[model samples]
Every structure is written in structure tokens, then in C-alpha cells.
Target: MKKLCLGLPKGSLQEATIDMMKKAGYTVIVNSRSYYPTIDDDEISVRLIRPQDMSRYIEKGIIDAGLTGADWVKEAESDVRVVVSLIYAKQQLTKVKWVLAVPETSAIHTVNDLQGKKIATELVNVTRRYLAERGIVADIEFSHGATEAKAPDLVDAIVELTETGNSLRANKLRIVETIMESSTLLIANHNAWEDEWKRTKIENLAMLFEGAIIAREKVGLKMNVPNGALDQVLKKLPALRKPTISSLSEGAGYAIETVLDETIARKITPELKRAGAEGIIEYPLNKVIL
Candidate 1:
């Protein structure tokens, strides 16, 4: 069987990626000591790679496609095809940032203050380029792990990736500058992207992934409304598309259904009830591919 080798980020993004795949209609199984994961799709083989290294692997065509942070692509300077931007992180459905931080008590309060200081980060090349653009001369050191803790003593300042500022605050670090903001990207190898089969497969997966992400923030609502109060109920609804309304049997009013943001669904449920909506049902959605 012809198979497309796929790389899934192993560290922070692993669990989230696996869950996303499940929601997108794929089952991915990973063993404790295995780098290769078993995905239900026989046409696609899965391997676990670090997000930082994902771009390089894709650039080399080691894997047909993979999911990783956009920052890593720029950091690696890898030539690859970005299939789609998946805006999600390990903790939340939002972009993550690489920021320049210093100890809260440090004298450095701005990027210029790092003129000749040493900095620590896993993203060495990107950090170097960022400082170079500002004409700031600083020593950029490569940190294997625990980059947030290398400041104040081992390094004068540090460049770290954060979803929230909680970790930085806990480490007593203050952000002086935001270097870059990145979201997860579904990327493909240049060569693989030119192949019809692989391209179609990658695009299908990207579509499904996007649908699952959108579904996470939305829900489906269905209710019955008296014909006399139809206008009121309709006014209370906020929908991605027009609210779906159908007349009931004989003289019964209408059965209305629509998809809307989860937050809006909650707030408007009471208003809908007051508007004469009956048998109201709010349900979870697996996918919303509009």
C-alpha cells in the first residue's frame, strides 16, 4: 500500500494533537516508548517528532506532512508548504508567543537594554536574527530544556515561548518584548505537496482538523416555537447561517434549528425560552464545516 509518512509533534502538543485527530475522525494510538504512532488510517503512517524539529524533517522530505508551531518553520528557515494554520496550543485555542524576558528585579527593562547581555532560548537562530534586526549585539545561547529558569544567574535574560504569562510570572520573569506569535500549522513537504495523492490526503485532514477546532467553540440548538412568537424566537438567535425553520405537523408551529457560538447559545437560551421557544435542546457538535 502506498503510504504518506506523517510527523506529529511529540512533546507539549502530543496529547492535544492526538485528541484533535480523534475528533477529526481518526484514531491514533501511541505506546509509551514508541516514536511511531499507530493511526487508524492505513494510508498515512505517523511518527512523533519535536515541534522544533518538525520543519527540518518536512524540509528534508522525511515526512510528507506534519503539525508544528509556525515559529519553528521560521526558526529552521525550512522550505516547506504550509497546508493550513491551526490556531491551537497545548493549553488553549490561541496563538503562543516567544517573548524576551528578564528577571523582575533586573536592570533590563527594554530590548535595547540587552545590548551586550547573554540570552538563553531553544530558538537560537530566530533569536539571533531578531536581535540582529534591532542592531543589538547579544550572546544567544542554546538551552536544551527549562529555558524559563536559566535567567538571572546562568543567563542575563531569556527568550521563552508562553501560551499564558503564568509560567513567566511564576519564574519571576517579566516580558520586555514579544519576539513572535505563532499558531500550529499543518505543513507539508514541498515534494509531497506536488504529488496528487498526498496533497489530497493532507488537504482532507486539514479540512477535518479545522472543522473540529471550529466545533469546539460552537454548538447546535434546536427548539419548537409557536407561530405567533416565531419572529421573537428568530430575533433571539445568532447563527452561522440562516436559522433552519420547518413547519410542524398539521397546525403545530415550527421546529427551528441553528448553529451558533457556545457562549451565545448559553446567554440566549433563557431569552429564547421567554420568546416562547419550547422543547429547547442545546447539543454538542463534532464538526462545523461551514
Candidate 2:
């Protein structure tokens, strides 16, 4: 079978994507100045491309599959199948929003206020469509970069992407409205999706990536509890489905294991201990299939 050509996004999302792939049981190595990354998998070849260009290239069949933001796919109007929506951004594992913003002191308080105003943004097409949807006609300029700084003086308002909105607030800007929410997506070319061999491989990769993402927010917990208190201890603990329980040798105790949200471990641990659970173990997880 021919090797699968995959394009990895090369900007801010690059490191995080690579790390996730590593956790998903793939070895990815990219040099500081190199666009071609080497992967340990023999069935796949990797190339680094900007997120903004990934959708169009995949649609054109330049590559079999790639990872890029949902917004880019929409902006490019590419005809590709989204294998999965990976909800993450540069430094955050949450949805990011593209918003219309202006100076805090500006009189523009709503999307309608920008009827004839000037807006700067890197997403020219998305911005144009957004304004047209609202029946507002405004001059949209393509910002090379630093779109947030172009407002007030360079433009009347700006459409910028923000994960936490901290950057906008720091620049003394307030969001007038959210234009769209985007998440990372695994996309496949139409031809690739139709090929049986390629479809299986792409689906396998998507499953692994999704498993790795699930593992990031969860942890495995194991502990032993007296038979008398087993029921009580189990009642206080939470699991993805149900906790795994097993008999200890010679009926010494019950060994219990389960997967749970990492955030609740601190509180749950103490509660379990008080309920006669012992030898508690908490560990990080690389992947969870379920």
C-alpha cells in the first residue's frame, strides 16, 4: 500500500499537536528550521504546513489528511470530510472564538454599530460573511498580523481570535460580539476517504488522537479496602463507567481500581481514606480507549 501523506500544522499549535501525537503512540520529530517532520510510522509521511493552508491543500488532494482549525476549513470553503473535531487551541484545551472587538471607550457597542466602520482581521472572508449575515456593510482590511493592535487608529474595530479574551482586555479592547467558535479538526480528502486502505488508517489515527485527548483530563486510581467498608468506599468514588473490583489474595481485602477526573482526585482521595480505603495510588494516563 502507498504511504499516507499527512500535513501537520506548523505554527503555535504545532508543539501541542506533536505532543498529543506522541502520547497517542506515534514518534514525531521536527527540526527547528525544517518543514518536513520524520515520523516513526512507516505507513505515514509528514509535512509541516500552516493551519490556514491545510484545508485547501487537502481538498485539492495534495495530501491525504491533515489537522487544521475549523475556521480555516470554512474560510477556504474546502470540500473535505472532518474525521474528528479536536477541541483544543495553542495553549488551551478549549474552544476559541473569533470576535468583533473595539476600543473600550469607543461608541461601537454592538455589531450594528459598525455599519460603515473599518475592520481589520486576518480572516477577511469569514469577517466579510459575518458582516453580510448581519446586513451590515463595512470595509474589511486584511491584517498581516497583530490584528488586535490595529483598532482605534488603524481601524474602527477588529475581528480577532481569542481563547481566553485576556489579550483583548490587556489591550484595552472589549469584544462587541463573537463571530464564530472554532476547534481543531482532523480532515480527509474526498479521494482518500473513499479508498478502503486509506480510510482505515485515517480512522485509526483519529481514534488514537481522541484517546490521547481523553487521557489528558483523566487519571487512574487504585486502592485496597476492607471487605466491610468496600461498599462505602465505592460509594464515594467516581468512575468513567463503574469501578473495577477484585478479591484480594486469601480474602484479605478488595482491590479496587477506576478511572476518574483528575480535578476531583484531591477531594476524593481523602474521602476514600476516611472510608477505610488503603494503599491508594493515583497515576497519570497516556490513553483511555473508552
Candidate 3:
């Protein structure tokens, strides 16, 4: 069996990364505190490490590929080929953010207010670059973990990833400015592509992962509608293609199904129901392919 070295990010990216792998038909089983995990696929060798170190290992040709944030790739300046953007972690594929935040009750209310203030974060380079662009300077302090708690105590503000900002609010912090927005990127070494067999396998992995992301954004909507409303429903329904229309069991109407964005779901569902559709079902997708 061929081996494909894989770097899975530790910390915040670990859970989501592993989950994505499982959803993509690979199971990573860890029995100890070790960095290495047992993967179900014979083609993959999985190692868990901090995302900050991922690009270096890839750049050095130690790992064949990795599931790390795009921010880390840029911060570490690793020369690895990015094959796909995992749609987890930050929903947006690009232009992600790490924000500078301060306590809501504190005097610091905006980005300008953060000037000359002490800000703590793990992303020093990202913070520095963002602050440089805005022409505002701050005393950036690096924190390994618990950076949120240190804010307003050991520091006045913090630069961190904002996903729903629930944690920031729970820690009594409000975003003052966005530092850097990042998305998880799949990267492989330049040399990895040199091996004909390995490169083909890597590309296959990328295809499967990308399909999983597409699947998450969509759902398989199946319903039965009056044959009379078929044309009208087709006009109103937003699907990847013409809704799959099949004859109903009793020959009452047509059974239709399609792939659609989850965002427009709620609105379209009621319309389907109003259009004399029944057995309307929306299911979470695991994989989608064109």
C-alpha cells in the first residue's frame, strides 16, 4: 500500500478537520496522546500538529499534504501546492478574518481607539500586517492559549478568529477591527506532484474533499407535487437542474427531487407546499458531484 503523509492541524482546526475526513470516508482513530492517528485509508498517513507548523513540514517535504488554514500557509511562507479549500472552520472560501476586539463596556469602541493599545493573539504576523494596512499601531502580545481571558486584564484588546463571535461575547469582548480572515486550505509539497502515483492519489483526495464541501452547502430535496403544477413549480424552484420528475406510485402526481443551496431552503419549502406538494423532505448531504 502506498503511503501519503498527511498533516492534520491541532487545536481549533483538529476537530473540524477530522470530522471532515470522516465525512469524506476516512476515519482517523487516535488511541493515545501521540500526534499520529490511525487512518482507515491505506493511502493516508495522518499526523496532528499545530497549524502554524504545517507549511514548514510540507515545504521541507516531510509531509505529502496537509489540512491547515490558508493563514498559516501564508504566515509560514511554505511553498506547497494548495489543492482545495475545505468548507469548514470559516465558511467563506477566501478573505477570512481574525478580528481585534475589546470589552464592550470598555472605552475602546473602534479600530482607531485601539491605537497604542496592547493586543494579544497567536497570529502575530497577521495582526501586524492588518494593523499596518490601517496605519494604526498596537503593542501586539502573543498568547499561546486563553488569550480571550487575558484581554482587558493582561491586555486591552485581542486579535482572534470570529466564528459567530459567541466566544468573544462570552468573554466580554467586542470586535474592534478585523485582523485577518482565513479559511482552511489543503496543501501539498511541490515535490509530491513529481511522483506519478502519489500525485494521482493526492489529486483524488482533493477531489473527494471538495465534493464533501459542495455537499455541505447543498441538500437533496425530494417531494411529490401535482402534475398540473409541475411547470409552475419548475419555474419557482431553484435547483441545480430541472427537478427530477418521476411518476408517483399511485399515479397521483410527480415525485421531484433536486440539489439546492441550504440558504434558500426555508423560503422555497413553503412555496413547494403551497404549490400542492406533499412529502416534502430536505436531507443533509454527505457528498455532491457534478
* Per-residue accuracy of model 3 over 1-290 as CA lDDT, tens digit each: 78889888887667767777776778888756788999988877888878899999988999988888888887776788988876577333334568878888889877788789898888888778777888888899778888889877799888887777888989888887776667888898889978888888888888878777777778889988887888777777888876788998787889889999988877789887887788999999887766
Candidate 1 per-residue lDDT over residues 159-242, each given as its tens digit? 999999999999999999999999999999989999999999999999999999998889999999988999989988988999
Model with the higher TM-score, candidate 1 or 3: 1
The models' CA-based lDDT, in order, is: 0.93, 0.93, 0.81
Across residues 1-290, which tens digit of lDDT does each residue of candidate 2 receive?
58999999999899999999998999999998899999999999999999999999999999999999999999899999999998768888898899999999999999999999999998899999988998999999999999888879899999999999999999999998999999999999999999999999999999999999999989999999998998899889988999999999998989999999999887789999999999999999998887
Question: Model 3 segments beyond 4 Å from truth?
Answer: 90-96, 105-115, 133-137, 224-227, 246-253, 262-270, 278-282
Evaluate model 1: give its lDDT: 0.93
Model 2 error, position 189 (Å): 0.2
Worst 10 residues of 1 by lDDT: 281-290
TM-scores for all candidates: the values are 0.98, 0.99, 0.85
RMSD of each: 0.8, 0.8, 3.1
Give the candidates in order of TM-score, highest first: 2, 1, 3
- Deviation in Å, model 1, residue 184 alpha carbon: 0.4
Report model 2's TM-score to 2 decimal places: 0.99
